[model samples]
Target: MTTLDKRQRVANPTYEPQPYSVTGYPTFRSFYPYYLGEHAHPVCLVGTTISLSVFVRALLAVLPLLSPAKQFAALRFGTQGWKSVGKLLLGGLLQGYVWAWIGHFFFERNKPATFKHPFYSLLGDLTLWKEVATLKRRP
Candidate 1:
């Protein structure tokens, strides 16, 4: 039997970064192609999703605790609850924000994908989370 050539044995790559000319556009629609390019690395997407999930959970938890009706009336008007909620929101925001920041700052600083492509960023986040779940279930 004839042997296959070594060059032909190599598997084709699945992902390639888009060229700068295609990715450099300023509009959200235009930037989405580049944003999709950045998400080829699953870890970045997963980290962002996890961070956002944690932030939302924290916010929901704090809402009841911070509500004026949930606490004593006299202390409610001027007290720590509002401050607590503000801190919680800030902390949650930082968690999600930092993940995207790290990806932009460290990995793909040239394109800065999330700045103009919030929708695709969110799509990447959810898609990565689903991938993680599927992988975890594999035998």
Candidate 2:
């Protein structure tokens, strides 16, 4: 709403993202082909790769604090650590969506399924990320 509100929101992010699923597809196997179709544009693929890289690195950075040896609540990351988590998660999400949107609107000329099918779209992104990472497919 206001500058103060934005700062407060960023300082105390209320959202915690978790993987979810919808009835959009009976199984991920059934959905992969459709996901591939939506991401046919080269720009979309590139954007996805970059976003996933950032997100994975961020997740890795934050993961040690969550390990069983540390006992999640007992391990304190303080302000900087928290900020790192926020930056990685938010930055990757924002970056990916922006590029994907641009590709969809300008190049691909299609509406992103992310709006209607967030869970499936996420699965699609991760799946593609794996393919690209393993050099199975080009992103």
Candidate 3:
């Protein structure tokens, strides 16, 4: 399959850190190609999607607890509702980590890039989803 072929090329790679810092790029224009290169393995795409989904789920859980919404929610559904929201946020966090670990260790057989470059890796994850979803990049 085309997807499997693409993954094989990136699976057994060496780490040659680019001479320039990932954060050193003044604009995303200079940084995006490097980000895409880092995530060429299909597993990275899977892990990033899982991670971002969890984040969005957590945000959805937390949004109801903010300011005016918090008061309205409390009055409408009481403490039990707030407890469920907290649980959802915690679960999202746990699931995100677990999925990321699985993707790196089992699927990619490589350490997560996020450990070294948090900001750029995150942007890579988010934009990678867009690229792949839009068929601009292949997994």
Best by lDDT: 2
Model 2's TM-score against the true structure: 0.61
Q: Rank the candidates by TM-score, best first.
A: 2, 3, 1
Q: For candidate 2, list the clashing residue pairs, or say none.
A: none
TM of each candidate vs. truth: 0.51, 0.61, 0.55
lDDT by residue (tens digit), candidate 2, 18-129:
2234556676666666666666655767677778778777766676556656545433433577686787788889988898889889987777878977887888777776
Model 2: worst 10 consecutive residues (lDDT sum): 10-19
The prediction achieving the highest TM-score against the true structure is: 2
Task: Tell me the lDDT of model 2 at 65.
Answer: 59
Judged by whole-model lDDT over C-alpha atoms, candidate 3 comes out at 0.59
Candidate 3 lDDT, 47-102, residue by residue in tens: 55665676566566555566564444432322555786666656666666677768
Q: Pairing residues by index, what is the TM-score of model 1? A: 0.51
Candidate 2: C-alpha lDDT: 0.66
User: Which is the winner by TM-score between candidate 2 and candidate 3?
Assistant: 2
Residue ranges of candidate 1 with Cα displaced over 4 Å = 1-13, 19-34, 46-50, 63-79, 136-139
Q: For model 1, how does the per-residue alpha-carbon lDDT over 1-139 read when each residue is reduced to its tens digit?
A: 1223432332222334665554356554554445455555544664566666666755565655656575534333224665755666676667777776776667655545456556656665555455445542111
